[model samples]
Structures are given as structure tokens and as C-alpha cells.
Target: MLKKQKVSLVVLTLLLLLNIVGILNSTQYLLKILFSYFVLIIAITFLPFLRQKINYSYKLQEILFGLPMILPIFLFKLKTISFAIGKLKHFEIFLIYLLFLAVVLLLLHHKDYRMKSSSPFIKLSISKKEVFLTILGMVYSIFTEEMYFRFFILSELEDYSYYLKIVFLVFSSFLFVGAHYLNKWAASMFTYKNYISQFILSMLSGNIFLVTNSLFYSLILHIAYNFPEIWLILKRLKYQQLHYENDGAFFDDY
Candidate 1:
């Protein structure tokens, strides 16, 4: 079992390195997209095997308790939910889940606000293939990331002391954010916003995994958080195409 854990950790680390290289190297878009899906498939396969081998127990209570951890941008809201959960009845787990959905919606609104105000209107000439690949890559990338940082790394440190857990959390969060920082999309004037958001989400996802003992909660939150950003990107691409055809040299203006 120990040997398996060690091997799993090594594999995850190597995968992380490969993912970073895929982001940093100026590769073809299709290749990058394919690589992202490949890494995600490996992560999805390995995480479940490792979890079973390690006998990781997931509890319904922990999953409910962890739902509020998604509101990392609103710490006070999370704290309130955490406090309220203890007083609620066992049947109120459903209520808590409903509340979690509400919080997710609110967070999505907040994300939309930030994205509208901060994200640059890049005049992209993306084809249908590129659009499909980008969306697939984004979803796959998120899955791979949550599997590695939350399920693999954080789960392994579960038996450690609080201090040790915190140390690993910070280390893993740095790696998560660093991966994004190295990405081509984030290497721009507005890069700091991406870095800050990624760091906070990484920390929050780690905490969610700690509380829930399940990767599903964090994975849902990650996808919810990214949905608006992806939509905006697609909308902008469509808008850019319309204007580019209407006015020649429209791309040059941006």
C-alpha cells in the first residue's frame, strides 16, 4: 500500500511537470488541447484507484459541511454557513445542499462581475474547431487540476497534523497557481488578476477537500466558477467575428 502511494505521488508529480511544460511551451493549439485531455484522463483514472487502495472514507456530513467552503471570495458567508450547519437537523442536509446551490449562484454572479470588469476584449479569430477544443481543454484542465491538488496531494496529507496539513496546502496551492501563471493566456498585462484568483481558488478547493473528504464538492465548485468566464470568452469571439467581417482591419483596433 505504501509503495502504491509512493508510486502514485511520483506519477502525479510527473504529470504536473508535463502539464506545466504543455502550458509553457509554444505548441500548436490542437496539440495543447489534446495534451490537456490526455493528462485529465490519466488523473481521472489514477485518483479513484489510489483512493480505493488507501481506503479513503467519504462521509455525507463532511460533504455537506464542505459545501460552504466554495465561497472563498466571501469568507464571512462561509463562516456563517459553517456555524449554522451544526445547529441544523440531520434531515437539513438537503437544506444545506440547497443553500450550497444558492451560494454557488451568488459566487457566479460575483465572478461575472469581475470577468466583465477585468478581462480584456481580445479580438480573436477562432474557428469552430478552436472553440470546441478550447472549451474541452478548459474543462479537462480543471478536472486534472482538482484531482491533483485536492484529491491526490491533499488527500495524502489527511493523516498529518493541522500545521503539516497547512504547510502542504500552501505548497500545493503555489504549484496550482504557478501552473496557471505559466500558461500563455495568463501572460498578459491583466495576469495578476488570474494569478490572484487562481491562488484563492486553489486554497479554497484544498480547504473544501479537507472538510468534505471528497473531490466531487471541489470539482463542482471549480466548474461553476469557470462557467461564466468560458461563456464570456465565447461571446467575445462571436462578437469579434461579426465586427471583423463588417469592418475590415477590426482586429488592428484592439
Candidate 2:
């Protein structure tokens, strides 16, 4: 068991490093797709080994409890879209406030603030095909991440004492955050705020896996948390393209 744990840790660490490289170096669609496939292959190859270690049963309740914690962030994104569309009526704003309050209360009741601590910034100029590929890549990447960080890393420490577990969790979470920071775009804007937020997300994700004993739950939460960021980025990209086209046409007419 010890030997297997050590080997898995080494493999996961190397994979994380490779993933960072892929993120940093892949500047075009083909390169990005290649890297994504590379990660997916590694993840799929290790799936069986990781699956054996997971004992958590899938229950509807886990999703039910976890989904609402994400509502506030989605609401915030929706509020942005609403503002973009037109002026929000007084009643609409008031209703949004009420919804936000309710979601906060629910999160507090469930102690889900950990999941709410951070948001990911996805700043990529991707085409429509790349967007589709990116979504698929993200899904696969999330699976691999849960397998490595949550299942393989965490399970390896299960037999140890609580202090050791906590230490390993923090250590792994730091590595997880470091991997994100390695992305070329993210690294340029890296701040303590991003670091802290990623740490919080990593910790919460690990805890969710521990509690639910299911990587699926962690993956679901991860996707739910990240989807809005992707949506926001796409919206911004579309708006920018429109503005650029309009400016070009105006100059051409003049």
C-alpha cells in the first residue's frame, strides 16, 4: 500500500507538471487540443486504479445539497447579463437582492462558503470550434484533477493521523493552485487574491470528495463553479468583437 501510494503521488505530481507545461505552451487551437488529449489519456489510464479507492455511493442528496451553494455566483453572472441587456427595474433589482440573500442563507446553513471563496478567470481568445473543444477539455481535465488531487492524493493519506492528513491536504492544495498559476495568461495577473481563492477551492473540493466519497460530486461542483466563468468570458469576447467590427466600419465609411 505504501509503495503504491508513493508511486501514485509521483505520477500525479509529474502529470500536474506536464499539465502546467501544456497550459503554458499551448498557444493555438491544435496545440491546445493535443495537450488536452494528452491529459485525457493520462487521466483515463489511471481511472481504474483510482476508482478502486473510491467508496462513496452516488445519492441524489449530494447534488441537491451542493447545487444551491453555487447559485449566488450564477446569480451574480446573470446580474451582469441583465445590466447588459437594459436597465433593471426597481422591482427586478429588489428581487435579485432577495434571491441573493436567500442563497447566502442557504449556503451558510450548509456551511458551503468554502465553495464560494473564489472564481476562476478564463481569458482566452478562442474560436467557436476551440470553445467546443475547450469545454470538452475542461470536462476531462476536471476528471483528471479529481482523480489525482482528491482520490489518489487524499486516499494515500487516509491511514495516517489527522495532522498528517491536514498537512498533505494543504500541500496538495498548494500544488493544485500552483498548477493554475502556471498558465501563461493567469501568471501575468497572479495575485495573492487568486492564490487564496484557489487554495480555498482546492480545499473545499478535497473536502467534498472526502465527505461524499465520490469524485463525481467534486467534479459536478467544479464544473458548476467554472461554467459561469466561461460564459462570462464568451460574453465579453462577443461584445469586444462587435465593438471592433463597428469601429472598423465607422472608420471605413469616413
- Per lDDT, the best of the predicted structures is 1
Model 2 residue runs over 4 Å out of place are: 1-128, 233-254
Give residue 80's lDDT in candidate 1 (0 to 100).
21
Best by TM-score: 1
Give the TM-score of each candidate: 0.46, 0.43
Please give the RMSD to the true structure for each candidate, in Å: 16.7, 18.3
lDDT by residue (1-254, candidate 2, tens digit) is 23433454466556556667775453242233233333433333343345457744323223322332233224323212111222335335434434543453344333333333222322334345545545665666666566555665565444568787677678668767755544324546556655665676677667655544555555655665456446655654565466444323322434
lDDT of 2 at 26: 31
lDDT, each prediction: 0.54, 0.49
- The Cα error of candidate 1 at residue 68, in Å, is 31
**In candidate 1, what are the lDDT values of residues 61-175, reduced to their tens digit?**
2232233222221322211212122223432443454356446455545665565745565455555555665676666667656755665556556568999888878877876
Please count the clashing residue pairs in each candidate, in the order shown: 0, 0
What stretches of model 1 exceed 4 Å from their correct place?
1-130, 234-254
